[model samples]
Target: MTVTRFAPSPNGPLHLGHAFSAIVAHDRAARDGGEFLLRIEDIDGVRSRDELADEFRADLAWLDLEYRDVTPQSQRIERYRSAADDLLAMGLLYPCTCTRAEVASAAVAVGPDGPLYPGTCLRRGPTPGLDVAWRLDMEQAVDLAGPLEWTDERRGAQRATPAMFGDVVLWRKDAPASYHLAATLDDAADGVTCVTRGIDLFRATHVHRLLQHLLGLPVPVWHHHAVLVEADGRKLAKRRDAPALADRRRAGEDGRSVAAELRAALFDTGISLSDIINQQT
Candidate 1:
C-alpha cells in the first residue's frame, strides 16, 4: 500500500501553492489505490496557530482532499529529539555554534541545499561540551550511501549528489529541532510509502532522503509536480498577499472551485469547477 501525506505547516493560511500540493497528494493516493494522510507541521510554535491549522483542514476538506489520518509535528517532538539523541550518541552529529550571518558568510550558496560548506566548522566538528545545533558528520556518513535517485510524477527521475546536499543540520541552534528532522521522523512513524508535493521541493527532497538514510528509515517514493504561481510569476505563500482560505470561504467560493482553479492554472486542466466535483468520486 502506498501511503502518501500532505504535510503543511499551520503557521499560515492555505493558499494556491498549498492547494496544488494538496490536490496532487490526494489525487495520487486515489489513483494508486492507497491511503492519503494529512500531517500538520506546526513545530514552529512561535508562528503556528490552532486556528490556522483548522483552516488548513477545512481547506483540504473543501477541496475534497481526503486522507486516512492526521498527524501534527508539535505532537512528535519526542521522536525527533530521540532521533537527534541517537545521532549524537553515535558521534554522527556535532554542535554547530555558527549564527545565520556566520553561516551565510562562511558558506557559498550553490543550489537548493542552501550553502556548500567550506568546512569551517566541520574541521572543529562535534563540540562535546557545548549545546549547539546538531549537524551531521557527512564525512563518516558518505561511505554508507552515494547518489540517490528519486522518481517524479511530472519532471521524471532526478538524482542528488552528495556535493549538493552535505552535512545539513538536524536541529537548529535556537530551535529544539528543525523541520527536516521532524518531517522524516513523522513519515517513518506514520508509514508513508510515498510523498507527493510541488516541484520546488525536489532539491529539499534530497536533503530529506539523506536524513532518512542517516536515521535508517524507509525511503518513500517521491512525486513532485509544478508549483502554482502568482500573477507576478512568484510562488504563492501564506505570509504574503494571498488571501486566507477563510476569506475565500467567507466570500462563498467552494473548495471545488479553488481546486479547479489550481488544476487549470498549473496542470492546464480546462474544466468547470462544478463539473470537476461531480466527476470526482
Candidate 2:
C-alpha cells in the first residue's frame, strides 16, 4: 500500500533530469505493488503554461509512465489556505514584512537569499496582517528530531542540519499557498507513503520535513536519486534545458534511442536500445 507520486511543475518541457526522476518513481511503485499518481504542481499561474503542462503529460505518456490519478496544485489552493489558517490559529505561523535586503542585512544570514531568520519577526509584535509571504514557526519543529533523515534508495541516508533551513515560506504575498504548503497537502490527501525523486531536491528534504511536522502529517520514506548531469557538470534547469522531449517530438523522433541515452546517463546501467524499444507499451 505504498502510494507514491511524480509531482512535477508543468512550467517547462521534460528533460533528461525529469526522465530519471520519473522512471525511479514509476519503477519503485511497480516494484512495491503501489498506486502511482501524477500531480501537476502548477501553483505559479503566472509562469505555468498549458503547452508546457501538456508537454509534461505527453512526454510521460511517451515514456509509458502513466499514473492512476492526477491532482493540480492550483486546483487545491483552498486546502492549503485552510491548513495555513489552522497553523495561524495555533500561534505557530507568522507574517514578516522584511524584504530580502533587510533580512540579509541582519547578522542572521544563511545563504544569498537571506539569513536563517534571527527571530526578528517572531517576536516583532502582534504578528502583522500577513500582507507578505508567511513562514511557519520552526520552533515547533525543533524538538521533532535530530536534523532530518531519509534514506534515498540511490544515495542512502542523507540529512540536513536544522540551522540550515529556518522558517521556510508557505504562502506568498499574492499567492495563497506556495509549493511547500501545497505539496504537503497533496501528499497527505493522496496517501503518498513514499516519494522517489531527483537528488537535486536533497535540500528540499529539510523544508518538506519541517512542513510535515508543522502540519502534523506523515513524512513518507524518501528516495532521492542522483541527477543526470551534463558533460560540464552543470545541472539541467527547465529554462534552457536540453534533451527536451518536446523538441524530439517536434523533430519526428520517437522510440528507443532517446530512452537508452537517458537510462545510460542516469544510472550508468548499460541498457540496450532494444530494452527501451520493447518497453514501449
Candidate 3:
C-alpha cells in the first residue's frame, strides 16, 4: 500500500502554504486508497513550542484532513541516537567543532544550502573535550553507497549527488538529530512510500537519498509541489510571519472553503491564493 506523510515542525503556526501541502499529501493518499500519516518534527528543543503540536492537530482538523498516524520526534530521540551511533561506527560520521562564524570565514564556495562547511573540522580531527556536531563524511560515504537515484512523481527520475551539500550535519550540538538524519529515519520507520513536501526541499532530497543508501532504509518516491508564494514571489514562511490558519478559523472563516480555494488555485486555476481572494472580493 502507498503511504504518504505530511511532516510539519511545530515551531510556528500553520499557514496557507502548509494547508496546501497537507491537502496535497492527504488527497494523494486518499486517491490511491493509501494511508496518510502526520509526523511532528519537533526535535529542535530551542525553537519548538510544545503547545504548537496540539494547534497543528486542530488546524488539520479544521481543514478536514485525516491522518492515519502521528509521530513526534521527541519520542524517538533514542532511535535517532542509535542511527547516529551506527553511522559513527561505520566511520561515515565524524565529530565537528566548527562554529557557524568559523565556517563562514573559511568557506569559499557555496552549495545548495548555503556556504559549504570548509572541512575545517575534518582536517583538524576531532577535538576531545569540546561539544561537537556530527557531520557525514561525504566523499567516503558516496564511495560506499555507490551510484544511487530516486524518483519524484512529477519530475521523474533523479541522480543522487549528496556531495553538493558538503558533509551535511547528521547530529547537532544542541539537538538529538539534524533534519537529514531524523526525517529520513522517520519516513522509513513510518513506512512512508511517498514523501510529499514543497519544492524548496527538492535539493535536500539528494542528501536524503544518500542517507537512505547508507542506513539501508527503504526508499520512497517523492513529490515536491510548487510552494505557495506571496505577490512578490517570496515563499510563505513562518519566520516572515505568514498569516496563520488558526487566525482564519477563529475569525469564523470556513476552513473547507479555504481548502477548496487552495486546491483550485494549486491544481486548476494556475493563480495565487491572493489572486483568488482578489477576484472573490
User: Which candidate number maximizes lDDT?
Assistant: 3
lDDT of 2 by residue, 1-281 (tens): 87878888766777766776787787778887887788888877677776677777777777777677566887888889899898888776788787777767874557423576666777775456757778777767565444666555566776644446677777887676876678778888888888877666667776777667667788788887766655556666777556677776677666345555555555633333333334543
Task: Write candidate 1's Cα lDDT for 153-215 as tens digits.
Answer: 566777755446667788875556876678778889999887777666667876677777777
Q: Give TM-scores for every candidate, taking all chains together and pairing residue i with residue i.
A: 0.86, 0.83, 0.96
TM-score (C-alpha) between model 3 and the true structure: 0.96
Q: What C-alpha lDDT, on a 0 to 100 scale, does residue 75 get in candidate 1?
A: 72
Q: How accurate locally, in lDDT, is each candidate? A: 0.72, 0.70, 0.88
lDDT of 3 at 220: 96
| Winner on lDDT (1 vs 3) | 3
Q: Considering lDDT, where higher is better, how would the candidates rank from best to worst?
A: 3, 1, 2
lDDT of 3 by residue, 39-73 (tens): 89998878999898888888889998888656699
Lowest summed lDDT window (length 10), candidate 2: 268-277
Worst 10 residues of 3 by lDDT: 267-276
Check candidate 1 and list the clashing pairs: none
